[model samples]
Target: MLLNGRNAVVYGGGGSIGGAAARAFAREGARVFLAGRHPEPLQAVAEQIRSAGGLAETALLDALNQQAVNEHADDVASSAGSLDISLNVIQHGDVQGTPMSAMYLEDYLRPVSTAVQTTFITAQAAARHMMEQKSGVILAFGGSGTQEPGQYLGGLITAFEAIEAMRRQLAVELGPYGIRVVTLRSGGIPESLPSDMEGREEIAGAIQAATMLKRAATLEDVGNAAAFAASDMAASITAATINISAGALIDW
Candidate 1:
């Protein structure tokens, strides 16, 4: 019940991680607003939360639309008295598995561009509301990438880096207003995404073996972190980043 009576807006509430976070937030006593392009999935998550006697609602939206995002933020704040948390996990499918050299420039950078634009707009909309109330938490996601030559993960790495930077800057700018911006960076999550011909067990094992803890991050791990970030437990935590990659990071 860390988030009792709070109001939370989840931009990609239809996806696996987003849906998990939405449910977790609601379970903690927050009135959750699930927004996404897909109506059915968002509705399903809302229904589940409500069935559990939690406050949950669904909103059909294209997150990239700044005007719509702003309007939605206003509507939520109006209904809840004040917005407490905003998490953007919108999808931007511009990442093609091609390297910069051979990959068409258009396809190579599209995901980065789209993600930056949508996430920025959505965060800005929420920040404005949070600023008015002088309180809120903003959450975003990050990922890991292999550095092998020709491994080419498309532009996902670039996009994630940008997202991290944005979160840090937003944290600084919104700090005085009581809005905290942070990111939950993690390695591959297997609960929803299954492995392919490379072999599910092998790939998962390899990922675990590469991590310092000899294990991959779990959805529950992220959901818990997100809950804390949106709670008063993290009141003193802001302008910070938590790497939930199982120690799969090495800065050079």
Candidate 2:
């Protein structure tokens, strides 16, 4: 049990990646608090964890609400005695892949603003609890978008770029407190394919083809990576972006 007595909080726990991380943490012996805007999926994940004999809790929370987010963190800290890990997998609901000549300025800007603020609020809440313990982990799952100029995903690219920058600064500020901040840059995982997109199989296959490993990233792959970061295994690492893109994002 790498996380044998740890406490983990996962925002956006209703989503595929977030749900996977929550389950992975619980399996590693960490008590997990799953929060998101919806109850059904979060509850489902929590139940699954609990059924497996792991400790779990669920909260229907809007990531943008600073008060609610902080209050939830406080409760988790109080119950668990310390906060070991905080992971934000919240979605920005941004319209991605819009050509530069096609997307409206406000549309591109909206997701950026939303993602930044939610991330800030969640991180701020987590920081307070972690700072008190002087030992914790902060993890964010964000694409390495800003690396390229605005392309098809102008909206999300900008948002993720800002997220990466903010995550780096957080690493610097929180390192002194013995709190590690880490980011995961992922390539497309099959679970995220939109229902509206026709030919899901073909799209998934193409994404895998584009990867250097000739296979796309899996939910378990991400879940395990996140669990590793939150575990004592990554004790010496902080403020780093662990790229799990299967060589998709490399410049070379």
Per-candidate TM vs. native?
0.91, 0.93
Alpha-carbon shift of residue 162 in model 1 (angstroms)? 1.0
Winning candidate number (lDDT): 2
What does candidate 2's lDDT look like per residue over 28-87, in tens digits? 999999999889999899998999999998988998999999999999999889888899
User: Candidate 1's residue-wise lDDT over 1-252, tens digit each?
Assistant: 899989999999988889888988988999999999999999898998999999988889999888888999999988889888999887767544467778777776787888789879988988888898899899888744455454466887888877877877888899999888877877666664534534557556655766888778888887888898889998888877667778776444
- Global lDDT of model 2: 0.86
Q: Pairing residues by index, what is the TM-score of model 1?
A: 0.91
- In candidate 2 the C-alpha lDDT for residue 212 amounts to 92
Candidate 1: where are CA atoms >4 Å away?
143-150, 194-203, 250-252
